[model samples]
Target chain A: MSQALLTVIGEDRPGIVAAVTQALFTADCSIGDASMMRLGGYFTIMQVIDYPRDLGSVEMALDPAIKRLNLRVHLDPISSVALTADMPNTRVTVYGADHPGIVAGVTGALAAIGFNVIDLESESSGSAERPLYVMVIQGYAPEGVESVRKAVVPLREREGVEIGVHPIEAAVF
Target chain B: MAVLSILTYPDPRLQRKAEPVSVFDDDLHHFIDDLTETMYAGPGGVGIAAPQVDRPQRIVIVDVRPKLGEDCHGLMVLINPELAAWEGMAVGREGCMSVPDFTGNVIRAERIQVQAQDASGRERSYECEGFEARAIQHEMDHLDGFLFLDRLVSRKIDLFRRKQYQK
Candidate 1:
């Protein structure tokens, strides 16, 4: 079996997953690491699957998802990715009245300082008139956590958002 | 006392509820000592449960000073521990020796009061907050056959690769 990246998007519905997965099952493909969720009424899936056949077989297997769900799909043949030793050890949470450039300015500053973002989850919790954007990022920042705490200070002040950087505590044993 | 081997995830023994200790004698004291030794022997170990070492009994050892700094109770050996009361809530990341590969977000009470017996069968109670409370709840979960993965935040696959960032 080999690995391939498959992405799918369509109007949110219950059968979207069942349809796609059933097709893959029939094609002798099994999913590995996957992220499937609904974003603003549009359902999306980004996953790596271990397939028994070639990329064309995957496209053929996804025919049901396209025709039945009226979805757009893309299948890419990608080799298994090499993982870096680095994993996210810090948790950065940003929240403020929704505005443009919040993601850009904040992430840019952290990136310039060599922060590798591992997992990020963001959402707007308030109304459109008073939008509140909140994002939590997990990353590796080897340049010192104090510098990480300071990296987004300017952006926090300028955008009137709260940006907190702290090491993620892992409770072992 | 010897450092017993820890049981990793998917071990059916870990899912069984640990029996409550009815006797706290010399055997119990020695078991607690071995548990303490095992907790310190594991990489980044700070808390452990008896079932983790194939001892299906309500016992746990914890010392969070290494993780939470000086604000924690140095070393606690809780037998048949139970959460007496709890208040507030917070989400924190946790990794377990049993669940070796994945770490995930768990939402637990911020402040907690616990009642349990010591090795000598002496009753004791503890009041703690923050990471200390979280650690106790985590260990107690083992007594009830639950891991952090069972109480994940929002239940949206919050699990992540457990990584070591110690420099």
Candidate 2:
């Protein structure tokens, strides 16, 4: 029994998930946390799995299923390690015209402030000639939201982007 | 008079729509008391709904004065509440006791007017904004089988794994 990280990438289409999960089921693998989504135009699946079979058998099980759909797959063994102990405490959003350095500037501002980003999702839309960029970032800000708000102000001005920071509120109902 | 046990998410009961409260009596008052006690029983809870305790009634008790101050209506017991009007929109981080261990950004009306009835069955209305409105809206969602998770800005972008729910 071993834990492995599996990644699948292919054109977005229906039945992609059903095919992959079925292969895992047939291979007798226990699926862990999985994120299956369409990024840009490609459908991707990232899953952590525990397999009782050998690596070859697991690969063979997935080979036919993914290949038939013209998808690419990779599997790598992973050992548990604590990457960052800080949980997300604030949400930061960025919106501006698409440019070369929006990401670097925004992340640099955050890094300079000692904010550790936990998750980031970004997209660009609008016409090809006038594309708009928007990014949402969640991070651990031990010092709180005001600091995050302040840290981004300089980048917001420099990059000509609108940035907003909100402290994560955990209100019980 | 008694602290009621709140039902957490995936219990199915939390997903059941609550029935409108039609009768106002001593029993209703007692249940409201239990709901209030239960709300206070949780850490920093400012509002609660009857459905959270498996009561399946359109009742909510809210007290935001502790956080928002004198401008708020303070302790409010809203029964059969309905959204009368709302204006503007803003995104705020939200969490819920029902679905603990996660928080997400949820867009809510910046200001809202709510129509409801008090414990005596008399009609009442409240207009509030900011966190007070957010808290009331969060509790009202329970009556309709909605959790704050249902209102997240975006499933892919808003959710951050782990604790703290600003429901």
Report the TM-score of candidate 1, chain B only.
0.90
Best by DockQ: 2
lDDT tens per residue, model 1, B1-167: 89999888888898999999998788888889899999888876788989989999999888888887788888999999988888876668789988987888787788889999988889999998888888888999999888888886643333222332211
Q: Give lDDT per model, in order.
A: 0.84, 0.84
- Candidate 2 displacement at residue B1 in angstroms: 1.1
Backbone clashes in model 2, listed as residue pairs:
A169-B166, A170-B164, A170-B165, A170-B166, A171-B165, A171-B166, B95-B165, B95-B166
Kindly list the per-residue Cα lDDT of model 1 for residues A17-69, writing each as its tens digit.
88998889989999987889888889999998889978888889888679988
In candidate 1 chain A, what residue range of length 10 has the lowest lDDT sum? A80-89
TM-score of each: 0.89, 0.87
- Per-residue lDDT of model 2, residues A1-173, tens digit only: 78889999999988999999999999999899888888999999999999996878888898887778999999999874645578788888888899999999989888887898988888787799999998888888877888888888788778999998877766555
DockQ of prediction 1 = 0.47
User: Would candidate 2 be rated incorrect, acceptable, medium or high by CAPRI criteria?
Assistant: medium
How big is the positional error of residue A86 in model 2, measured in Å on the Cα after superposition? Answer: 2.0
| Number of the top TM-score candidate | 1
